[model samples]
Target: MSALRSRKIKYFFILPSIIWVLAFTIFPLFYSLGLSFFKVRLGKPTHFVGLANFERIINDYKLVNSLKVTLLYVAITVTVQIVLGILLALLFHQETKGKSILRALMILPIFCTPVAVGYLGLTIFYEEGGPLNSFLMSLFGAKIPWLSHPTWAWVAVLLLDIWQWTPFCFLVILAGLQSLSEEIYDAAYIDSSSEWEIFRKIALPMIQPVVIIVLLLRLIESFKIFDVIFSLTGGGPGTATEVFSLYTYRTGLRFFDFGYASALSYLLLAIVMIIINLFFKRIRAVYE
Candidate 1:
């Protein structure tokens, strides 16, 4: 009886967390899943539509374009973040005076709110008299449109994402670097291995798991990028920066197409899941 009571008490302790997940996570997920199969619009009675919503999404031109843009954004941002982050991690990993201060400063951008970052990006990329253009004009007597031109607007969004997220990659890689076995490095040095060889042959292989984990996390987050694009460009300059999340938000909130929006969201979820599965498979292959 006492053992049963103790088990009950332990369950009581976890009840709140279970309830929270049920109410916020699991319930909403199921609700959205059901909603995706219905034709739900504001001021109209919802009707069962089976796979109609999914079919509509598959045929959606805006969704297709948003997918392309999102893929481009994710590819560019994640690649750049990984490369630059690894370089920065290596540079800052050395013990030097002021290294702590520099590391703290590096994380400031990541610590800022995404909405705040987006608004700050808006100011920086403002067309006529923004600081970037102003500096360029003063220096070269040329002002390139940063926010108004479609290509430049895409670049601005990309730049904002890179600035905000590169620090995350850097911090993760730095942690991996710091956790490395010092004795291994000592032995490598005793063997007269060059720094490049030490990193490429030893350090990188040891940190491969951390790097893969960071890439997966960033890829998932980058796919759901909405606040930054919403506030920075508003998917403007002719839908050039309309990512999947932003497109879904515009459809559901702005256009009141709940069913279709739900479908698009599920598609995004599926894409992320597929990418994560691939990463896991790669990790298994590497380890096995």
Candidate 2:
């Protein structure tokens, strides 16, 4: 085919993706931004009220609480995932029997859809006769509320998050570790470097980029976490586990306040952008 024709063919193939992004991504972004300036309610005319929705955010106690819990959740889950993930990656990196099988089992959770995992959590954490509760009963004869109460509800959410995402961190971090040459470790050993010393000095610095990437990915996902919480707890027994996304969803859909919901979602976007910016700045500073 001629160059022009070949290029035209490629464009033809790419056209659907371009349209999809425009329709779903770009349009909704600008649309939401515009919507945030309006006072939209069900069965009422939409009227622009400049900065009202954003201003209201300052006094919205529920919104503030949601952000707080969400941040706490992300902080705990991401930290645990990173710390435990690194340990598991290191364990799996060493030669051992049945480790391949253990790695396979660990990563299986990552392959499961968040919704499916949520439902699975529902079963496992059932307070009555559930596997976890039943095991607890057998051992201690007490039923712990897995989906009720603020503290336990938070625990449930964080636990499921840790269970699902830690494997992903392990897999990526392990890949980064495996890329290092054996000669590096042999040299370290020749230098009389202890195992912890090698990890703290050589392995960590080498994998810093990988760890940052994983942190960014997890932060983005955890901030927007909805599927698992929705399927598992539905924002819980009394909104105790409601995160930003869940609150925005309720405001827009359940309460039919699209203006405030749009504003809330935009705020979430801003928070995520800030986080990503800081990470990128750190990454650049490191290289510089």
Candidate 3:
């Protein structure tokens, strides 16, 4: 009786969380999935359209372009973040003056809200009198359009993502570095191994799990990037900066195309799942 009662009590404690997930997560997901199979627009009777929504998504030019832009953004941001993060981790791992203060300062950008960061990017990258162009103008008497041109707008968004999220990668890698066995490094030194050889052969391998984790997290988050691009560029000058999430938002909210938006979102979800699965499979194969 006591054991049964204890189990019931435990479930009672977890019931709220289960309800929350069902109400906010699972229910909405299933509802969206159902909605994707219909033709739903605001103030209109929804009618079952079978696979029409998905079919339309497959033929969507904006979706295709958004996919390309999203892939490019993810590729550039994740690659740069991982590389720079590891390098920063290694640099900060050394016993140096102001290391603590610098580490504290590094976390500030990560703590700031993404929307705020997007707005900050606007100020920093503004065309006429922004700080970046102002500096360039004074130095070289030239002012490049950071937001007006497609390429520079893309670059501006990329820089904002890198600045905001690199610290997350840095902190993860730094923790990995700190958790490493100093004894192994001491032995390597005793064997007359150079610092480069030690890091290349030992540290890198030891931190593989951390790197993978950081990569997965950054990839997922960057795939869903919207607010930064929305607030910064508003997918402006063209569809050049329209990421997948932003495109979906514009479709559903701005255009009131719920069914199509739902289909697009599911497509994105499937793509993310496939990529994640492939990444894990590759990692497993390599480790095996």
Candidate 4:
């Protein structure tokens, strides 16, 4: 076949993907962008409102509260997941019996859907006559309310997210760890007497780029956290766990404020874009 024909064949193969993206992704994105600039309601005629919807964000106290909640969740979840994941990855990278079985079990949580995990968490964190409280009650003779209190509700959501996502970080970090050259470690061992020194000087540097990638992915995922919180806490205990995404959802579907909801969603998109760009710039600076 001619080069042009081969190129055409490649494009033909990718045509479906292009069409799918345009239909599902690009179309809805622009549609929502248009919707964000209008006043959309169930029974009312739609009209352009310019920046009216966006302007409400400044005075919206609930929006600020939701943002604070989301930032808190994101900060804690990402930090704990990264630290615990690194430790677990290091532990499993050792030459130990049952390592395969242990690693398999560790990654099992990541395979389960977030909704299912949330439901499972309900069982584990039951306030009255629940397993966790039961155990704590046995130890301290007091049951700490997991779902009923505001602070504990946030804690419950954080725990669920950390439980599910830490393994993902572990998997990625383990892969990066395993990709290192054995010779490099051997040379480092000869030069350094302490294991921490060797790991700090050689192993960590080798896997840092991978860790950065995992951090970026986790940050984005944490910022968009919805499903787990929806099934687990329903963003309740009086809005203690209501992240920004959940609030935006309530604004659109519950309150029937599509224009404002769309504006909130676009704000979230802009925040994510800004975060991603910062990370990208940092990565570029490192490489350049």
Best by lDDT: 3
Model 2 C-alpha RMSD vs. true structure (Å) is 3.9
Residue 18, model 4: Cα distance from true site in angstroms? 1.6
- Candidate 3: residue 148 lDDT (0-100): 93
Model-by-model lDDT, in order? 0.89, 0.90, 0.90, 0.89
Indicate whether candidate 1 or candidate 3 has the larger TM-score: 3
- TM-score per prediction, in order, is 0.91, 0.89, 0.92, 0.92
- lDDT, candidate 2, 73-146, per-residue tens: 99999999999999989988999899878878887989789988889899999888999999999999898988
In model 1, the runs with Cα more than 4 Å from the true position are 1-6, 280-288
Which residue pairs in candidate 4 collide?
A: none
Model 2 scores worst on lDDT over the 10 consecutive residues at: 1-10
Off by over 4 Å in 4: 1-6, 43-45, 281-288
For 1-288, candidate 4 gives per-residue lDDT tens digits of: 234444668877898999999999889989888888889888242899999999999999989999999988899999999999888888888788998788889879888988888898899999888899999999999988899899998888899889999999999999999999888878887886598887787888899989998999999889989999999899898888899999999989998888899899999999888889989876777665
For residues 22-78, could you state the per-residue lDDT of candidate 3 as single tens digits? 999989999899888888779252799999998997788989999999999999999
How many collisions between residues are there in candidate 2?
0
Local lDDT at 232 for model 1? 91
* lDDT of predicted model 4: 0.89
Candidate 2 stretches with Cα past 4 Å from truth are: 1-20, 43-45, 281-288
